[model samples]
Target: MPRTLVIGAGVAGLATAALLAREGHEVTVLEKGTRTGGRAGVLERNGFQFDTGPSWYLMPSVFEHFYNLLGTTTQEQLTLVDLDPAYRVYSEPEPGSAAPHPVDLPRGADRVRQLFEELEPGSGPALDRYIASAKRTTDIAERRFLYNPFKRLNNLAVPEVLAAGPELARLLLTSLERYVERRFSHPVLRQILGYPAVFLGTRPQDAPAMYHLMSALDLDDGVRYPLGGFWEVLASFRRLAEEAGAQIITGAEVTEIVTAPARRRRLGRGPRRVATGVRWRDEHGVVHAEQADHVVSAADLHHTETALLGEADRSYPESWWEKVTSGPGAVLVMLGVRGELPELAHHSLFFTRDWTANFESIFGAHPSVPTPASSYVCRASASEPGLAPEDHENLFVLVPVPADVSLGHGGAEGQGDPAVEQVAQAAIEQIGQWAGIDDFEDRIVLRETIGPADFAGDYNSWRGSVLGQAHTLRQSAMFRPQNTSAKVSGLYYAGGTVAPGIGVPMCLISAELVLKHMRRDYSAGPLRTEPQRTARQSTGSRADGAGD
Candidate 1:
């Protein structure tokens, strides 16, 4: 069979392996981490379970569609329960105000409109129009933009793109902040509408107005939480991939990609180099090599290109990455409190009145400076009963910071660093006051923090960025990294860094895009039955090919 080696066991890697294996290709996945999930990993400590990353499950249809492709339903795999209040937003009190303003974003569109009307009279109708426009953007994106790989200019000439050209142009030209300002008069309402930009790791003013579709998806479709945690979704993907006959090896860090010169006489005018397999080291520090017909990198795109493939085999130059605008990194604090926090919901956002200062701090000129102006808190125990001890809560707090800030590798100085501690203290104090928990710090029995430097060590994230490249107008769609390698044949990439951009839904779509490109470029033929040969054996006894 045509053996394929996939790097990383993240959502994209697992999904790609599963889909390719189902297509009759022998697939094997290599994961550097000890667990299957990359950022969506689960952590258990002191009887409290926490999701390390991706707490908000915004797009349900995406997960449903993935499960459906595997001949099953998301309902069959995991029990997905809608968070009733969706989320709660707490704004810092205005001058002369007695307390902070807390807005509960309830499920259902009519109820959301009611809430908007309460905030600003006559805003209900405006919200209706805004959501309608957002829905149109979503429709156009799903039908025309998201599904296609955008590998060539001709891909933009489709009928759907032609039909939505005018609306798309308007959305592309406008900024999300500008759109929200034009649609809503109230500042709080504008913040609520524009806050979804952070999910894409960009400021509202910098992100395209088309992202307002996120608000429609959030308020109309509602947010969901898989029973147990977000980790359950990773488990489901792992199970599905394994069932599809794909082998996954955890704690196997890939050192280099193995490639050989293509047989020019047999395949005319193909690339000079073709990927043969990969060389990786296991947890025990033992080295091993696996041979395959094709290789897919679902790991960090920058690491895969520069670190594994080296400068000579890279399609993008060092200057290209320098120009890429990466998304914000984060400072995450996981707390296991001894008492309940009834004021907090399944998800909550603590926003400061000075949104501009906060955004600038995150995406500013001097990124290394720490800013703890806003925070996102996820009290998963509010919805899931077994997540924490009785009468206690599991709190996951994240502060968006500039990707350039350092917290020492693996958070070596996280506990004692003055800057990191300052941010954590600010977040804790704000959340405690907002939730009416006066003794919040004392209630914490266990605490863990992850900073940008930790993200670098753990996930090899570029500049410790939590998300991949920002979805700026220039960094989006066809402008993003291509799925196929330009310098080497049979080498492909799939992840947040490539086309379709960031988020779990995008990762799944990225895998499909890679598969589509692979089929188109290599031609859909039956798997070759010849046994895989070592790179040394195939390359005329070149023993040097054995090591990276």
Candidate 2:
């Protein structure tokens, strides 16, 4: 069996290792952090458990599909509670108004249609048409694009692509903002439709209309919460990996990827350099080098390229990285409040009247400190009793901020507590008035805030971006970084930073893409006839023209 080394125990890494191990490869996973999940980690403090990242569980079917691949179901391991009244959206009321306009989003399509009709007469049917279009986009993605790596032009010529190519092409040409504005007359409904673009790490005006598929996932399938928190999902990934005979070692920070001159010659030419092993340091400061037939980096792509591999060995240069647009950073405030927040739903969105300002502040050319008029609040304890003590609430507040903002005096190493506190206070005060939670700050028994700097220090995230690279039309699909490295043989990548793009579901798909390429390349021999660099150049041209 080929010995494979996977760096990082994030969802992508764990999934890759498990699948590879099942395929009879000797897999070993190395994680820099002490825990399994990278961004999707959990923070447990004083009887309160908080999911540090990825609070929204939007796509249940994606999770189900992954679990089913392992010959099991997500239901077999964890109880998933589907959230009813999917979420609540609170809009700052007009001048002279006493309360914010609160709109509770119901689960079923008929209920949502009714809610739309109530909000704006004649909008019910409009919403139905919009959702249908979104669903069609989703179908195109799921059938033609999501699974395939798009290595060659032929990969785009599938039967599903042939059937939905025209509609998909038209959707890709439009912007999400334009699509929503054309569909919804009500401001609240427009905000609701455009909100998912934030998770994609781009403003609605900039992101492609193809992203409306996110609304389909929200309205059609519904949002869900795992009983014990998102940590349970990570635990499940770890469990499956271990059961498949993949050994995961946490607190093992990989410093370098060791390469050796490959013995196998291609076309009677000189042997190429191939990744043979990795050097990592243990928790106790002991250094070790483990040899492997292949190396898969599921860590931060920028870190993997610049740090682990030498500068000379990088496929993407500094210039290419500079050109890449990173996703927005977030100010996450986790509060273990002393009492119940009865007015708030399991998921809530406090939207501002001016949605464009919120996007501009974060995704602008020279981003400033975000004075977000909108914020998201997740009251996990509202649905999951195990998350906090009885009569108490566990609140997770997220404010999208400029990824380029400096945390001030303390430097990037600091968790940006002062900055977080300042933002958190403002958000709490605003949300309190909006939700009628008087003395909300006073009820907090514990508070922890994670900022952009924290993301950089913790995960080595580029620009301290929480969602990795933004899925701009130029940066998406084949244009994104390839899973297979052009500079190094036996080196592969799988994560949000690479193709298939961001989100937890994307991470799972990324692993599968990496495995697909690995199998195709390494099936018959040690190397392919075509030079990896040459293939990359050819593919790069196609990628550039792909958007056009």
How close is every model to the real structure, measured as TM-score? 0.92, 0.91
Candidate 1 ranges with C-alpha deviation above 4 Å: 95-97, 265-270, 368-372, 409-416, 521-548
Model 2 per-residue lDDT at 211: 92
lDDT of 2 by residue, 246-349 (tens): 99999999999998767787795632678999999999999999999999999989989888887767887676798888898888888888877878999999
Candidate 1 per-residue C-alpha lDDT over 19-96 given as tens digits, one digit per residue, 9 for 90 to 100: 788778899999999898898888888788999898888667667666666666565667667787999998886566
What lDDT would candidate 1 get against the real structure?
Answer: 0.82
Where does candidate 2 have its weakest 10-residue lDDT segment?
Answer: 522-531
